[model samples]
Target: MSMSVPVVGNFRQVPEVAQAGCRITERPENDLTDYAQLLDVIDVGICAVDRTLCIRSWNAFMAAHSGYGSREVIGRPLFELFPELPQDWLKERFDRVFDLGVPSFTSWEQRRYLFSFPHNCPINGGVESMQQDTRLLPIKDELGRVVQVLVCLFDVTDAVLLHHRLAETIQVLEEERQEQQQLIARLAETQEQLIQSEKLAAIGQLAAGVAHEINNPVGFVMSNFRSLEHYVEGAFTLIELFDRHIDVLPAEARAQVARLKQDMDYEFVANDVRALVAESRDGLERVKRIVSDLRDFSRVGETDWQWANVHACLDSTLNVVMNEIKYKAKVVKAYGDLPEIECMPFQLNQVFLNLLVNAAQSIRERGTITLRTRTEDDHVCIEIEDTGAGMTPEVMKRIFDPFYTTKPVGKGTGLGLSVTQSIIGRHQGSISVASTPGLGTTFTLQLPQRHTTAM
Candidate 1:
């Protein structure tokens, strides 16, 4: 019988005695060495099975890998000789080679260990079993009829282990990348908070000084206005007495007095004088109220929690930002009567100022800004709505992000909403907004009446 052998072309240490695919006839015993010697010398594990799946030939490489001698495995059924073999899978592979006359291949990635061969290479010395890359080849007879199949397996444990290690390395690098991004975000937020805190501190100092400096002048002006009002009343009474005595005067004197009174428009002057003095008094009172509001809003040294009137906070903030808003929008206040709640009034006042100023700036020319306050369950809700150029969803998403702004070059600092959010967070409050482009924007602030923790 002729044995099937693979062509070992130019293999190191292979003898050049037989050409590949050359079948040997049942010649003299000395002629067998021409084909048999090459198959026994190659390192690639080789085994042949006939149509009945009986082990027909087992080379030296197969004997070394499987630990079975050629004499023991030859002539036995391949599935019976190796009980651990995937019998059905191997049979299907064999059928394709024997029945269809086509070869098949299986990579190490698909099936790691095929024969459970013990590790032999120094590079894979630590591995408990060998990994293999296998191939099945058809063996045809002289009549071109397929009679047997040759199975070849190559050790590939080192390559598979290297691939696994590289994959694990990539996973670790991805995790590190995500962690670095998170750290950078935290650092940026901290830096923004520091800058905002310094700005607020400076403003607090300035507000305190300005309020003190203006308070004295406002106090004296109000006092002097009251005295002026009294003087105007006395002057009007004397003028009335003089008119009553005019009829008793000599005819010549009476005529002269009438001409003087007519020329002076005395009645009109008297009425207008009273109105002017009243207006002056009202103006002085407004100045005094503004100074008082400034003092209340800049109460910076008083950091401890205290009961605060919410209505007063809203009113004071309105006055503080009146110049910015009055020219842009009509302000409407719907204040709800509520009890005082514990909070840092100055910080809350800052929040109100930021929201009111932002609402005003949103308007291109003129709009209406409505401030509404109402008590909900355990909290107070302050809503500031403006009929201005509203925000798109893209802009609204990053509205409170540090250094983000929609305003023109020099008009906005971009820190208003960010600082407002920080202060509200410390107060354990929340702010939310809803808007539609070209329609308007509404910002709602919810504050707990009494926070259990200190800010």
Candidate 2:
């Protein structure tokens, strides 16, 4: 049986329906009031409950969707018809409206649906439940006393789901942007490393060629000088023998010999020739040492580990940079007894050379550059200290960063300390610096006695 009372009247008799001019049904014997007429035709879901929580009205929209006809649910308690409802909260909401006669509202964002009605859109295929926006209206009697509450629900499923998907899309794009930035940074670092390697290779080749060419000519000249020394000595001996024999010569011959000796300054030439020859030999020896140092520094294929004296490598490096530091700083070596360490000797020589040159350039005037070494347990320590104008704290912080320079633009390439650090790292060693602005700077290197065979 249909619990909805069909409206049958002169439609003009129900003023609310007459205002909208809704036509009446044919049966005039079953009469209907204006309120019931209006509830039957509205688009929103509408239901009215009395103070006792008994359903007083269930409209056509509510009846068709809830699977409960008006006859079955109208006289029952609201929760008895729908056991899934939150009984306590719904009762409180009803009590507030019945007691105070005020309205209330809730959105689908806060609670997805109140009734769990099926969303029968063909586009969605009814996979998801309907989303709702609900409102509660207080119904009052003539003296303004609340009698019943009307519940209205609006479907808002599409808008809420669209907003959720847009937020997720934004988050995904942001993560992809951050990953691209990191890849670009890595490529830039690799490019700089390749450029530096090519520059080092070219320098090594040039140094090796110069040393080889100079060595051949120097060897022949040294041999010729030695033969000339012997010849000059024999000539001096002949002159001395003549002085002894002068007493036996004729008077005229003696006068002529004495005159010739005085005119030629024979004694002075004899003494000076020996001195000049000795000085020339010493100069040649220095040239030989310089060539040896250059060859060691610029060797290309000495990458294997070997037992080498750290002190000897330091001495060779010092000789190589002697002219640069000799005028500006006096070098003082404070050597400590240390065992031979297994290392790449050529690479370590490069480290020492860089430190010595930096110490020399630090001094504004004449100062003492000290090289100190010590053995601590299984490791070796070397310190290069200069009594020169030292670095400030800011300069010390980034001293090893590639291409970061405190020197004037053209005077430095800024890779000296950075390359020194790389070689030390390869040897399983550490380097550190300490400085004060007015006093001086010291660089300390701590190296393991031996490294593993791994490169």
Candidate 3:
């Protein structure tokens, strides 16, 4: 006997499925019989429901999985037979198919299964139930009206499990890649820091040698200068006594001596000698002060923490880099009362040198670099501000990152600020920066007054 069977097709007449190029078709009675047999024998679950949600057809796959034979489920309300289904949501899907005469689909990703059938594979034991990919196709009558909706359930439990496993594997791989990148970055930073430390050590040694050599010559020169000043003063006094005794000489002799004195320009020489001596003394003193500043700044072999004056450290650092700054910017010292702070003096000097040199380099033309210092409770606050070409927000964000630089290739190694920050951290201190593009930039350092072992 021939029975009605739904034929799957591209429902092109339905507005929603038109773009999808789908339409339902009818078959002869003999062909319908063959189709029904094909549906019953197939592994997929096939069933049909009418407008009142009554089951009209049930296939072998549905009967086997649901444990309800065709005779028992047919003509029964679908919701009554399988009350575990999402009645409202599933009804809406069926209603749309019936009214539009189009097919609707739900993947296993969207919903695990339409019916609670345990998965058949014992190997994939992680899944508790069968995962299904479901579809609803409209069954049309001869007059082109939707009489019922055909539901097809595909067991996609394996595919769903594989997808979840793939996603988990990908997530694990991504996390590993991120960790490797972070490790590589940290290694690069550590290497750069080591190189910088070696360079600083070499520089300190060189500075110590130079300071020692200069001190010897300076010491003797200063001693000789004192002796020369004494002799010159004695000669000047003798000349004054000679001038007072000129009245006792013969008039012709006195006239002769006056003429000789005028020819020698003795009075001018006496006055000029004092002026020359004063200027020489001042120059020597300046040299001595510079040498002293250099020695203090280098502090080779002085790595242990010690009580140091912050202002003194800054001044010594400024003196060491004065040549670099003098040509590019004018320096202004706005000092305030500050107490001694325990720190690595040479390292602090390095920090100040880096900041001061950076401030000088930032100015393309002549500008002012102002050094300000003050006491803030238990900390000494120092600020190096420059009226130069300042940084953009983006540049400022990465300024302390190792090996990140905006300067010309050879002009910067990009480790200066990074090293400066490390030194501050070692001192149990903090450094912060503020900048405006056209106006200027300021780097403030706050160092604690006492050293802590945690640092």
- Tell me the tens digit of each residue's lDDT in model 1 across 343-400: 8888888889999999999998999999999999999999999999999999999999
Residue 132 lDDT, candidate 1, scale 0-100: 87
What is the C-alpha local distance difference test score of each model? 0.81, 0.80, 0.84
What would the TM-score be for candidate 2 when compared with the true structure? 0.63
Better of 1 and 3 by lDDT: 3
Query: How many clashes in candidate 1?
Result: 0
Regions of candidate 3 where Cα sits further than 4 Å from its true position = 1-160, 232-278, 452-454
Give one digit per residue, the lDDT tens place, for model 2 in 1-455.
11112234443344442222222223344654455556777767888787888887787778877988888887789888888776887788889887887888888877778887877562333337777888877766535667677788776766656655666677788788788887787677657766876777778779889998999999999999899989889888887897888899999999998898899997897789899999999999999889988999886336778899999999999998999999999899999998999889999998998899889889998999999999998899999999988999899999998777888989877788998998899898999999999789999999889887567
For TM-score, the strongest prediction is 2
Candidate 3 TM-score, C-alpha based: 0.62
Q: What's the TM-score of every candidate structure? A: 0.61, 0.63, 0.62
Clashing pairs in 2: none
Alpha-carbon runs more than 4 Å astray in model 1: 1-189, 250-265, 300-302
